[model samples]
Target: MTRRVFLSIMTAAGVSLLAAMLLILGMLQSAYTQRYRQQLRDEAAYAAAGLETGGTAFLAALPAGSGRITLIGADGTVLYDSIGTQDMENHSGRQEVQQALASGTGESSRYSATMGERTYNYALRLEDGRVLRVSAADFTLPEVLRSLAKPLLLIAVIVVLLSLFLALKLTRSIVRPINQLDPEHPDKAEIYPELSPLLDRLSSQSGQIDEQIRELRRKQQEFAAITENMQEGFLILDRDTNLLSYNTSALRLLGADDAVLGQSVLGLNSGSSFRDAVERSIAGEHYQRTMHHDGRYYQLIANPVHQEDGIIGAVLIILDVTEKDQRENQRREFTANVSHELKTPLTSISGFAEIIMSGLARPEDITHFATNIYAEAQRLITLVGDIIKLSQMDENSIPVEKEPVDLREIADFACERLSQAAAKKHITMAVHGSRETVSGVHQILEEMVLNLCDNAIKYNVEGGRVDITVSRDPRGAVFLSVADTGIGIPQSDRERVFERFYRVDKSHSKEIGGTGLGLSIVKHGAAYHGATLSLESELDKGTVITMTF
Candidate 1:
């Protein structure tokens, strides 16, 4: 700031000085040129009057020293030459002389080879028909100008040097006061009023700053210790690739085992969920995600951070959620299983009561009752089997084991299992696909497919078409899609279709012996295999249940 102020002052002063100098030079040159021209004209007018008063004898030189003098006759002939001998031609053609003859006064400029410059000429024609012309060659004004040049140049140099010296002194003086100010109390700064003060606050502040720096260093060490001792991982980073700071817990959870200060978070872990979390946070998303590593699950909460300046960084707090997450997952599965267990029995009891109310007597009545009981029992067994399978998935991290089960064969078997039930409902079922070799627990996947096919047959209208399409999606993800042209589920119930104990038509589902846990089991199975479950349907139209694994 001081340098800038000084430079500005110097620039203004220099510009004013330069403009004044030019004005002075211009005025002086004008005054001198005018005086020189007037003097020469006066001399020519006086010399001409003398010639008019005396004749040829008056032109004869009585003067000791003067400029060139020439006299011409009335008929354009040179009468006399005082300065030098030269060819006498027509005086009427001479510019100055011709002008004097034409207008009674004349002036001209001519190249003087002797002076190597242009010289001024003046003339006056007398009443006696004689023309008198005078001219001077030397430029005395320029020599005076040359003398002023040296002085002006010297003044300019002195100004620049003095300005530089003053700028340095002022810069240093201002810097001392600035250095004295404490950053913490900068709003109320103190500066020395005197050129030299007893306090010398800059020196004092420097010492105090040194002490404060040591204190800050100690505080930083304590902060680091606190963060290290904290069980929850803490990570802070800017919007840039540079990671700011991380605690030991963060390093333990993530691959950044050591300090990642000033390092790129991207380079530390390539295939990590942390990278995704960071990207989302940088995009201004505040979210939490669970990541599992080495038999432990970490809940990472990515929150955006800001300072006085605005959004500059993000802080990610990581907490171990392995135990709680496992418990919650177990609870969800258990609840589903319990619901499934209760549903099948309830359906059986309701079906039995309905059959009892109907008045078919003896063997026919007994056969109908026995069939209904068997159907309920089979549904219960299927529900229990699904519950056991889902429980096994939560008890371990490794999948329930994979085998090359031709999905074609499984689909065939599922169809066979559900074929009898579909015939009872008078609903048609079919299986269609290409390659059917996939890796998954056969019993679980079989149940999932069978449940979907079973639901299609059960909910389907009498004689309604049940089309099972087994295929792979665009990403080569294998899918089992069971589409039915039946009284489809409503849009509002679509989201809860896979939820435990959730049914589209409550009364009708009981009548058809629905476990109400089939879709829930399907959902859990798909989740364990990292698969996606979805359904598209509209009321009174149709339904498509797809499971992609």
Candidate 2:
């Protein structure tokens, strides 16, 4: 800014000085030329008067350095030349001589290129028929300038030096106030009045910029808070796949440390599929893939961040899909198990009926075959009913209406219904404890108790006992506990006992004549009623399953 101002001042000064010099030189040249012409006229008139008074001898008497003098005859012939010898050209064609012959006097000027001068001529018509002319040659404008060149250059140098000094001083004066102005408080600075408007605008813009910066910071903090607390892993990467931002969940899911930040995303997981997905997203394509990290499944979704120019970066979202995948796998397994379970009883019933219809059975075997067919059909009905109940519970389509159901009554009813089965196994079943009423669907509660008691009877040893207890814990929560002296479950298999179609003893499951879905039904029913189920068991001892609501 200082240099610019200095240059501007110098330029203006240069132009003004040049203009002044030209104007002065032009005026001086004009005045000098006019005076030279007038002197020529006066010389001619004086010489003419002397020639008329003292004859031709008067020209010889004229002083030296008076200028050139020529006398012409009336016949257009140069008769006398004051400064030269004989032969001379006629002056008839000369403008001044011709005009003087026609009128009383004439004046003209002509430049001589060869002599580098301009001649001013004045011709006077004397009383005689002859004409007298006086001419003086002086340097032309170009010659005049050449003669004054040295001094003019010296003067220009002085003027330029002076101008440079003034320009520097003026530039500093102009720029000093601006430089001293406080950017933070432009309005408070003492500055040039001419710059007041600029200062005011700067102050306003500074405030606006401060406000904008604060707003940007606030939004950044808000965004950080939201992403940091998110359950899903979130990551932001630049076009080059460098990690720009990431949440803690992202680090955990990717199994990476803080060093991964600012590094390539490949540092977290260098798998080809992960790299390919990131590359595709940076190329403006949305991509997704399932990645296995640390034995957990993650759904990795990469979406391009776009601007008017094109894709600038990418956002990667990693969702934990371990549970979801497990559920899907379970559903497929359950479908297959249902098909197999339903088919077995159906095939048995079909075969038994076919034998009876074809009369392959003798009269003595008819009752036995018919009875087996009825039992298989009844088993099929029970399997189908359990499947339907499970399906309803899984879909959350169970009746929402609830009533106060006594746990003791449910236990007693289950024992009564399963008494014949318990007697067949030589198992004694009893219900104890006070009536504990829990708010739940009565049908679901009844099914839960019935399944528990039935499972105890089916899995029990000969002459085993089943105890159903309904009571409250210190927390004042209603609880129902079913303990059975049965072939106790192993610790490892106990966790999976509630899974559909899961069985501890798959070999004797057929001999037991019980669907493996009883515990699963009880689990689903307890979950629907917002109750927590716990199991305590030891091998060769007994299994105790409790539901607390």
Q: Best TM-score goes to which candidate?
A: 2
Query: What Cα-based lDDT does every candidate model obtain?
Result: 0.76, 0.86
| TM-scores of the candidates in the order shown | 0.39, 0.67
lDDT of 1 by residue, 383-471 (tens): 77666665676564445567776777778888888888888878888889976677777877888888888888777788888887778
> Which one is best on lDDT?
2
lDDT of 2 by residue, 1-549 (tens): 556765776688778977987887888788987887777778888888889889889988888888778888877798887766465666788898889989978778887443356777788888877888887786367766888899888987876787678778888888899889888889898987899999989999999998999999999999999999998999899999998998898888877776466778878877776788889999999899998877889998999999998888999999999999999999999989989998998898899889989989899998998898898889888888899898888888976688898888888899999999999878999999998898888998898898898888888899999999999989898889999998899989988999999999888888876778999999999888889999999888789999999
Candidate 2: clashing pairs of residues: none
**Model 1 segments more than 4 A misplaced:** 1-382, 396-400
Compared with the true structure, the alpha-carbon lDDT of candidate 2 equals 0.86
- Native-to-model Cα distance after best TM-score fit, residue 179 in candidate 2, in Å: 6.2
Tell me the spans in candidate 2 whose CA falls farther than 4 Å from its real position: 18-236, 244-249, 259-262, 280-288, 301-319, 415-434, 461-476
How far off is model 1, as Cα RMSD? 22.1
